[model samples]
Target chain A: MSIDKLSGLRVLCVEDDPDIRAIAELALGDVGGFDVKLCASGAEALSVVDDFQPELVLLDVMMPGMDGPETLRALRAYESLQSTPVIFMTARLQPDEIKEYLALGAIDVIPKPFDPMTLGEQIGGILDRHSGTTGYR
Target chain B: MSVNDVQASLVALRSKFSGRAREEILFLSRQAEKMSEGKLTGAELSEAYHVLHRLAGSAGTFGLPDLGEAARVLEKSLKPHVERLAATGVADDAIAPVEPLFLRGIEGLFGLVTDQPASVPDSQNKTVEGVDDDSHGTQVRILVCHQSADVRLSLVQGLARYGFQCLEVSLTSPDLAGVIAESSRVASVFVVGEQQLEGVASECRSQNVGGRQLPVLCLAGHDSFEKRYWAAEAGAEGFFSEPLDFPRLADSIERLVSERRYRLSGRVLIVEDDSDLAEHYRLVLESSGVEVRLVSDTRHLMQDLAEFQPDIVLMDVNLAGRSGITLARLIRFEPRWLSLPIIYLSSEDDPESQLVAMSEGADEFLSKPITDDYLVRSVLHRCHRARQLSELMNRDSLTGLLKHALVKQQVHKELASCRRLGYRSCVAMVDLDHFKQVNDTWGHGCGDRVIKALANLLKNRLRETDVIGRYGGEEFVVVLPGCDVGQAQSVIEGIGRSFSELLFFGNDEDSFSVTLSAGIAALNDFSDGDVALEAADQALYQRKSAGRNGVSVYTVPE
Candidate 1:
């Protein structure tokens, strides 16, 4: 896969904490060099997913209203986003909990307190591996 | 955007987050109070849980790990309560039992937030400018002399991991002595093959770096008592037989470098009320480069301890009007001075009195009319042991850096000194980039090596007076006294660059390198050490956001 596969990629970040949301924007947009959009909550993400048509969605698992899995399900309801890769960013990464996230069709889970410096590369690697098998557009 | 702009934005965002977190904690406290008063319904309980859940998830990401962990514990504890309230409807009894628990959790969480040094608004004007470039000249250099090029290259590469820049010189060079003398200004340690040890040791013994003998480490092909004896006779401080254990060699080199960096003299506080005797003891200790403070009045013992911060105390059993045993007991009452070594001085050699002095927190009892040599030896040994014990207790075993609490205390102390002397100081938050990936990919052992390598780098590169601490796993807090933010940025940037170049070997031939990102904040800019450290952390996040392997100085956004 090309290294630039992640560059200029349209990514949506959904986090309730404004500080974390801003940091994610910088990580994905500035450091990762990806086209990024940030949404405060699952509701905000749902409202923007169709129009933005992001290539990837980075969802926070424990949001206040309409959490990550619920938001993923809601986004999957949109016909266009059914096969779109969604990565869950979470703090809780117990084995069983990770299984639950994967069962919900999340491409992978990037644990919280992530290295903002390499967030984009991490997402890119995950996408590269998943696309090899699933071949999602 | 420029890296500086991004860094500034990140700092602003962090302070904003701190402010918002404070408000959120306040709100949570109020909700807890409401629950205690039976005024909270199911909605409030759920809202409180969400607040805690948010804190648990986000606090660590913002560099508040303690807060995040505390919030996580409280959130986990409150999960069942929230679920029960949601499932059973508004039952007052269901919430009653959790009221106290919820309140205590809120208080603990609030303490974490408020413990952040209140941000001082006007201190921004005092940010120091014009940081001299020469101040960043403390990088450790090692001179390597070996017969084989392969051995030289391997040694250089291995030493580089410990942040030493190795200058390789051919062992057959006729000007070996001249090279040693010329490199004395830069090179701290000399490493040579066992075959070349005699020549290198003779040359290194004559060369000194900063008034100390250059340490020599010999790499031998085989281990033997004769070779060891030969190396020792030739003045080699360390002998490592191949295959070389780089970590062990690095540890020895680090210890030697630090010892050469600063040879701190012992400090003794004498509580002898006898004017003549106290003066005599002070003169005797001072002759051996030991700092001595004599207190004629026992009434000022506590004040003296606070001000002097002595390594050891010498108390005469008989004071002018008070008992020295009582004074020793008083010193032991304060937990901070409990580790201090106290020796009683008494003319009477009664075994019972000596036992009594030992019982009242005295470490040793010395009979009066002792020779000056005996006093110096006893006091110096006690002082050295006390310092070593204190360092062991206050240091992280893995990195040999100050533990988290001690680092924070050092920052506070530095800030106080900066404020008093009107000098600049900087607190830097340094974290290894993608450290978790290192652990997951190459096992915990390799990860530990990486952390240790970084610690060695920081210890070797920074000034001797700088206080370095392992704040958390793969996170370090460095307090740079008399350094402005700009100076710290350059120093830390150098470290970050060297750290990225270091390769850690995993199973098989897999080698990976990790980078570091550091954020620095001027101590004068923040109200207290915690706020200053937070600012530094915010700057660190900024560096991470702008890409890793760099340093960013925190600038207050206009």
Candidate 2:
């Protein structure tokens, strides 16, 4: 059941932590009921961007080489991914920081230590709110 | 991803990731040691922070909150100096404080690695489902306050359809207020045929407690006037007869509990010249439940900082006529915006210029044509880190309570609130009796445990809204926002009694109980928080002069 929070949604998750990555995988794929792709790092995520053609990118804030925001910038280089909603999943939550993430073009910031059970709902809720907005894939 | 599958995956990942997580901390610590010895280059210092940064961000998620927390503190403490070195090519003089912090982080990891007993496997702590404390915001909990077990069970089942899957409390639970306060915000409280609703009712109506307001409804077998009157008098918002208008009741519960509002979703102010790119960014941010404002002109950024109050700044290094680095530096010039994160979006990949921009006050430098994911993640991390560091600065390193100044400030705010609301508030001064002797006799480690035990007692005993602060080395001050002198004294006395009962172990084969003395002052007795504090301190002094382990109230001097 691929629910239509954002129409025909496909999500690519990039995280360095394997545990978090797996949790996100389940949250996005199983609980969220969406077409999902998981990548270990920003570099791997960038390599598969065109092939996966995800409508949204769920990224981790901290990574080994090219971090999440750097990867977000790289994703925008592709003509196909310019307007995609990028959500950052991070353990670090300070209100100002969330605002900063927004300033950086991320549609949302998901606090890390995220609940796998409600993770899908949280993402879907964000998608549902933004679903009506124009110019979003 | 069923819940079970997610849990299974978590259990599996725990085993896989722990070894690597250890390596991650060890590597960062090694770099930190190198930096301490003045060996790491400026680039290496920045690199060290990033590696620790990743570890800090992930360690908590991997069932190692202690390691994650240590890494977080280490990352934040090292960041400013690292940024300074990255920018100015400054030597290692600024890094004097960083080495110890790095060593401390390494020590925390080492503690984690060595803590497991020989008999227990590593897998025991790794299971997500096993931890009683881990509530991951999954099942919906409804606290059922009924005097009958069968009725409680039935009501629990009735609400199951609407997704109130877990029953937090039943008829046997003595204090509904305590249960509700202890649990992660119960969705609703259904009081079935109960006459006295004092505990939960006080909790539900109280603005001072600060727990999420749960709708309280009463259901009785008879629609008698006395029952309805009692329910109304008891502060039940809704009353239902035996047949139980289930639909109407469900509607009320939904209206009260499920209509939860979004709390502080991210807000952004974009300072970029590219109109199309700005629009794209705005849409993306807005879609993810973020509030976005675009300003192509950089002339009035101070005004925007006041109004929009962005957590992170996203601007191009080369803007229209004005350099983004210059703007970043200007922003940092103001004390209020010093910690405001600024991420520079530039097309250049040159490391030297990046360092210059960083030196100029940019928190991060992202090359242009940045992927949507990369841009978002950087902004998020910078913003979060800045906020966390500021928060950490306000907290005590030992007891994890508010620092002295913050406690006094909180008392001032609460006293002002007490005046406006015309409610009684009280301040308490808590001091351990014969603490120095305990420290001298049992050594500092045992003394520390005794201090921590008291703090934990205060946290457990006090309400969430009540402000607690570590006022001194062995003293704590608590501001009870809405508590009168009597209520405050009883609460303090309860803590004192419990603390005296607690047994703290000494160095070898000896263990002894620690007793604490407390003094309470009412807001009405003094003009401000400081004055109230002085009165409380005086009362505390009196308690110490008399037999210890007693709680004394301040009397107004004529």
Best lDDT among the predictions, by candidate number: 1
RMSD of 2: 23.5
| lDDT of candidate 2 over A15-122, digit per residue (tens) | 886667775776677666778899998889989987999988998887779988899989889999999999998877888989988898998888765645456656
Tens digits of per-residue lDDT, candidate 1, B1-558, equal: 665565565556656767888898999999889878888877877898888877777775554555776777667656656776777775444455445655766777754552232111111111112111112235566778888888888887777656566777665667666556545544678888988888878766664422456788998998999999988998899998876767668877877876663354688998887776676666556644577888866777899889899999988888767888888888889998888889888886889867876988998888878887788788877887787787789889888899999999999999999988877888999999999998999899888888888888777666567899999999999988876676677777777776787666676466778999989999987778888888999999999999877888889878
Global fold similarity of model 2 (TM-score): 0.42
The CAPRI class of candidate 2 is incorrect
CA shift of B186, model 2, Å: 11
> What's the residue-level lDDT of B65 in candidate 2?
47
Q: Which regions of candidate 2 are displaced past 4 Å? A: A1-137, B1-312, B315-323
Fnat of every candidate, listed in order: 0.23, 0.29
Residues B446-533, candidate 2: write the lDDT tens digits: 7877776676556545555678999998999998875678868876786677667655558435668889999999986667778889
Chain B TM-score list for all models: 0.64, 0.49
For all predictions, the C-alpha RMSD in Å is 24.8, 23.5
lDDT of each: 0.76, 0.68
